[model samples]
Target: MNKRVLRIYFLISIVGLLAVYFFWPKYEKLPILETVSSFQLENVHGGTYSLNNEKIKLVTFFYTHCPDICPMTMMDLMKLQAQLQKEGIFGNKVELVAISLDPENDTPKVIKRYSEGFSADPLGWKWLRGSEGDTKEIANSLKMQYQKLEGDFFSHSTTMFLLDDENNIRALYDMAISDNPIDTTKILEDISILIEGY
Candidate 1:
């Protein structure tokens, strides 16, 4: 090539390099909040459940008889389950767990029925229940709060947590903290980012 052509090509290469360096999209990873210990809970199927060091977990709390928010949260998660399966990350890289706050009423049978009402897949999603103290302990560790109301309803924090394979608390998405609720897309995006990290 001629000297003029070579010089133009060199300038173009430098410009391309600069563009890539300055303009390429970057994904900021979700922040790790704290390390989580594997706590045991009972799945609706009468099997033991824990956050094993193998999959990313989307953990939330709910009760079978919750008037509104709990059901809304699980419905949102059912949508999320579909999205995760469509993305081919449902079982391999991601799992969902909804722990019951009212274990006394949310027996395995009740929770199983609840899980079925939403078409929750047992392989990808699990509805869990533990003793009242254990459930409270897990909630407290995730910085969630709950109270039993006089009307047999529980007022609780609707905070969703993301945990890595090692059971570390990676990120929290509080559905109650926002005037505009956090949509499922954003939650899936965060999960995608976390999965990509692994």
Candidate 2:
């Protein structure tokens, strides 16, 4: 009877350990898709922002006057910004970049107001605008296509990029899905993997 009880307890312990290992959040080391081309643009705060940095970055492209997709993406990012802030990594270990596709219209003042509308913190979230040619160059490198439509509108790709500290494109997340625009939980897990140097 004593031996049977000990075996049963050992089996239960093994099952519990296996459950934890399989069910607990696991962050795999993300692959380096490609190195991003270094670019510099004007931040909304009147400062120059560069892609060369020693911090993880989430990069997206948008225009202040975007009708639907851009605004929705920003909303999702605002939620992500809060999570990163709560984790105490925002602005320090991780940064968010939103580059303007409509640089002509998204001037410093315009972009600043847009950022404010989303409650984007300048310390961690950067709203950048540059010349049309420069903006196209960066967008092309990221495989983000955009075409100007009539009267302050654009048809653009709704993809968000995740970059490691070394400016390597690590992952791409879709922002066009209506049901789930951004997977904050998955992003946070990936960020943790990068932060842990996995």
Candidate 3:
């Protein structure tokens, strides 16, 4: 090609490389929801909670009627809980809060029953809910979008976010695909890393 064209191409290549290098996705998050309000909800066990004062926790969203996707996601969460329990903070510092997407149907009673089905322990895990508007606002803030399907079903992403003691979303665990479940091992690794960092 011509000299001018070659120089332009080289400049573009350098710019592209710089963009890719600088704009790459970060492996470690720097507290995205740094100042989000401390959310309040009623637990299936009939207790009140706010994320601000809660311990280090795993938080996920699901509905009682979600047959395929949510159930799988819950199983993965349970596995992570189990792993955490085996390591000993199952009761002291670790908590799993699964918020309901279907607030209309997932009342305190329904959430309690659902938690039972998932082998949820009241001391460690919670099936939580709030008003429809309240849930929508919280989900929007977290970027956990969902849409109602036919027969009042729902389609939503299967992501469990880990929150530290400060209520920041420390890690996002995407567990929709079967081949790649939430990395409990990595999550635990991060928890330790963060704890050390603090």
TM-score top scorer: 2
* Candidate 1 C-alpha lDDT tens digits along 1-198: 999999999999999999998888655576667977678888887679877748999888888878777776777778888999899989778998888999888889888988998889999898888899998888888888999888668988878888888788878886533244457887887787777773
What is the alpha-carbon lDDT of model 3 when measured against the actual structure?
A: 0.79
The better candidate by lDDT, 1 or 2, is: 2
Model 3 clash number: 0
Local error of candidate 3 at 93, Å?
A: 1.3
Better of 1 and 3 by lDDT: 1
lDDT of 2 at 94: 98
lDDT of 3 by residue, 25-85 (tens): 6456446554356889987787697787657877889888887777777777778778878
Model 2, global lDDT: 0.90
**What TM-scores do the predictions have?**
0.81, 0.84, 0.78
The C-alpha stretches of model 1 lying farther than 4 A from their native spots are 1-28, 176-182
| Top candidate, metric lDDT | 2
User: In every candidate, how many clashes are there?
Assistant: 0, 0, 0
Cα lDDT, all candidates: 0.83, 0.90, 0.79
What order do candidates take by TM-score, descending? 2, 1, 3
